[model samples]
Target: MEASKVIHAIYTDDDVLMSAVKTVKAEKYHIEEIYTPFPVHGLDKAMGLAPTRLAITAFLYGCVGITVATVMMNFIMIQDWPQDIGGKPSFSYLENMPAFVPIMFELTVFFAAHLMVITFYLRSRMWPFKKAENPDPRTTDDHFLMEIAVHNNEESLTNLLKNTGAVEINIVNKDEDAH
Candidate 1:
């Protein structure tokens, strides 16, 4: 089921949120989601999220850009439309490559930036004009929220949440009677 259907508990304090997450994890509850306004120290580890590979992708994109730019410049200035203006050989591409530095640098940055953005969007399940499925608006502010699926353990989960210092508690179900 989608995480939006479960009850979400919001916290104003990071310490409280972290403790609650730890407690819930200890109990082996299925954590549906967590949201925070900013990166919390060590929160990724607490959430058990794996490390990202954006750096590797960026490096590969940069290489592709450089290769494309080099090939295009060589083909255009040396092979396709060779011109000898300064008594230099038309085939001397290696010596004349300094003139192509600007294009090469620009393409490298352009490819790296564009590819990294696309990768992040795809990884985060976001798209242009797509309505975000954020769990709670307060999570974009100073609040942190943690959501867990009750399954057959609502009572124990509530007790665990309260014990972990939740400022407010609300039980929710997607179907009727969850309200």
Candidate 2:
């Protein structure tokens, strides 16, 4: 298959980049990706991306953590070795739930946080010792890079980006394996 061509429009300021994104979308152009030095508020809305569902996954992870804590505490304290502390020889999980409240809360938080991090890393295709996929290193410091897929309308796209205050514009054939 032929390699796809993309236009990289570099902007110094994020405000200009935001305006340019709106204009590009208004023109019915497909934006491949955008890299910014810092988080740009409402950029996802401008790009028309759906909201992330990580929060739901985190809730599920927290639930699992709670279940595991409850089961483990019941088996270890009530079933395995029932201790008679404070004149209470009750071998019941319900009776000892109050003592396990802190453990349950801590495990829930720990599972949600750690699992969310792992999920994000896997979903983003970021693994240990993986090479960076950034097209320009300047984007990490002070520049914002906007990548737009070219569909044989390079001139018009270039003109539109130039008018939208792009500091530099470059057209290059995108590598299929790079993504």
Candidate 3:
């Protein structure tokens, strides 16, 4: 059986799309998704999406990278192979920390960036070479598509979308993995 019917409301401009989202939200309609050619600032907040925890995870990843760099540097330069800097030997890890600063900083940035990308992909359920959940191809080029589920109020939702300056509105059966 079909999952349910959904409305695909297309807009030509980002501003119009944002306003339409607000209007639909004001009408208490649940927005399944919004597709755009590029990022639309504040759209997630407008859609009432909770703030992401990715930043926190990135910070934690950075700390891990720094910790690994510290341990590796300590073992290599201080414990195993001692080096002389200026007039002091690498017996003290703290004293030799300046030389390892570059490695620590690089590892921190590296972990934060790479791990954040992977986390984002996993959280969003986006995978390379996977079938895209996008309903309209125009959303990839120049249009914005707002998908809203119909809860026995298709007529009201249709009229609401029409009033919100939607250029094209289509009613489509929900795809199995469109969510």
Candidate 4:
């Protein structure tokens, strides 16, 4: 990709960052990214991001997990190794279904939580050992950073960022980072 000028606006507090984001959006500027030390609730809504589909994926994974658990349990208990425990015959899957409820529930939650996290990381392009995309290290400590591409309106954008409670502003050339 060709190099371009990008603006990095830094804020010390998340509340100030939220207000600044609102001000920037009101001026019709596109925020490329925002780095936060921790999760900022409602920041995605303020940025006008669409709702994530991770929950849908989690539900599907849970269904798969429960189905697998049921099939595995049925195969082991009823089909492969049929045994009588305490003189109670374990032959009918329907009759012994209650015994497998805990396994089903645990597997459901396990699949939903683990697979959803993997899905989120994969969908977000945050695979293992990738180069860090964070522009400023301070953002990981106690600050927030907002990145905006400067498309020939550097002066105006800088002025706007300055007014939006930015603690520090830096102009970065994307060309230099490439090397």
Q: How displaced is residue 60 in candidate 4, in Å?
A: 0.2
Model 2 misplacement above 4 A: 176-179
lDDT tens digits by residue: candidate 2, 70-152 = 99989998998889888765569998888899999999999999999999999999999999989999999999999999998
Give TM-scores for every candidate, taking all chains together and pairing residue i with residue i. Answer: 0.82, 0.95, 0.93, 0.95
* lDDT (tens digit, per residue) of candidate 4 on 1-179: 75798899999989989999999999999998999999999999999999988889999999999998999999999999988886767869998888789999999999999999999889889998999988889988999999999998989999998988898999899778666
Alpha-carbon lDDT, every model: 0.81, 0.94, 0.90, 0.91
Residue 131, model 4: Cα distance from true site in angstroms: 1.7
> What CA RMSD would you report for each candidate?
3.4, 1.6, 1.9, 1.4
The list of candidate 1 runs beyond 4 A from truth reads: 1-5, 84-90, 174-179
As a TM-score, model 1 comes out at 0.82
lDDT of 4 at 66: 96
Q: What value does the lDDT take at residue 80 in candidate 2? A: 88
Q: Model 4 segments beyond 4 Å from truth?
A: none
Kindly give the stretch of ten consecutive residues in candidate 4 with the minimal lDDT sum: 82-91
Tens digit per residue, CA lDDT, model 3, 1-179: 65788889999999999999999899888999899999999999999999989999999999988998899999998998886767776768998788789999999999889999999999889998888777888999999999898878989999999999999998888865456
